[model samples]
Target: MANDKTSHEIGIDGAILATQVPGNNGTLILSIQQTSALNNWLLKWANYLQNEQTPRNEWLMTTILIKSKSLKIEHKIAGVSPQKIPDSQYQAQGQRVTWVLMAADIQTT
Candidate 1:
């Protein structure tokens, strides 16, 4: 997905913005700005994750890679305040609602 497009154009880029590996477990962090479109997308994505048995059902897991492999990650809708960026930081970007989601990956060697 092109970075230049406004958040409205793309619901969420299935990108792992950051990652951390500790022992056999991995953590993936993704950020999405809160736009009307993004809010709708998040709800659908979260529902799928919660209801689907196959982790592969999640588009983000299929599209995002960690350590050159598709990760079976578990996620939760983290509270908004901790993940929220200060208005001062996002005002210029026109992003009022922002969320940081963390996905946990259990890796088997």
Candidate 2:
């Protein structure tokens, strides 16, 4: 998704700037802005999702809803990881982080 007025108006703002669904396997790549508040939440959320002790299969079936304009896209959670932004791409406004969320299955609606 592009960082346009439409995208921002639809809820994709500073926190989550963009999203991409690669192929038909339901892999989602989220472009997010890093902040102290988000850092705390991301660590806990990512830890829980990445934990081996958690039931992976059940978690994989979880659905995430993304809304933009009049469109609503649903994605299933297969896995997730929080990655740091390279220094070269860092911006003064805030650090950039990529959150990769994989899906167990892809859905079309």
CA lDDT scores, all candidates in order: 0.40, 0.51
> What clash pairs does model 2 have?
78-102
lDDT of 1 by residue, 54-75 (tens): 3653534523333424665533
How do the residues 1-109 of candidate 2 rate in per-residue lDDT, one tens digit apiece? 2122233224545465454434444456765666666555765766676679977754444466554546665433333233332222456676666666655445445
> TM-scores of the models, in the given order?
0.29, 0.47
In model 2, state the lDDT of residue 47: 69
Worst 10 residues of 2 by lDDT: 1-10
Which structure among the candidates has the greatest lDDT? 2
Cα lDDT of candidate 2 equals 0.51
